[model samples]
Target: MSDTFFAYLVTLAYGDKETPTLAQVVFLSENEAEDTRTVARALLQNAKQTAPEKTRFDWSTLKVHGSQSLSDDELMGLVAAAAQGQVGVGRVSTLKLS
Candidate 1:
């Protein structure tokens, strides 16, 4: 059987701080996650390495159905908390794991 999965593309903005702020969130199916992740990471890398600005861009890929999955709402809430510096990456809690 082919298992289905949900993918979230979370954009972040870092401005003179160690913690990045949430910029946007986009939902996609598993099929599109890899391609989108590749492009997004490439762009993020380019911006970090080539851009001469103080602001930095990055992204987090959340796959909602695996060992590292989180509920949609929970993930969003944690993202907001992270923006406020209340949490850090890999600190988002989850209730289900498979």
Candidate 2:
């Protein structure tokens, strides 16, 4: 059986005045996802407190499966190739949330 990994596409937004930042974080299991979310929330809260304008910080998470369980280097290379291939991908970042 192939190893599977969970990837969470986290979209962070600070009010409606600015565009949301997109990030992908990959984890090995549900427990890791929980831990990662806790850290993410704390960081966002701090950001909300220090913003120039007072705006509520919100984030949405989308969970996906990496069926092939690609390594971090492999994933980075793939994203780079996609960007170079005129795929319209600005920048793809994958966070290692082990």
What candidate 2 gets wrong by more than 4 Å, as runs, is 1-66, 86-98
Candidate 1 residue-wise lDDT at 12: 35
- Highest lDDT among the candidates is held by which one? 1
Instruction: Give the alpha-carbon lDDT of every model.
Output: 0.39, 0.33
Per-residue CA lDDT of model 2 for 1-98, tens digit only, reads: 33444343333222123443233333222222434344344333433344223222222232114223346664444344323331121222334656
Model 2 scores a C-alpha lDDT of 0.33
**lDDT, model 1, position 27:** 32
| Candidate 2: 10-residue stretch with minimal lDDT | 55-64
Q: Per-residue lDDT for 20 in model 2? A: 34
TM-score of 1: 0.26
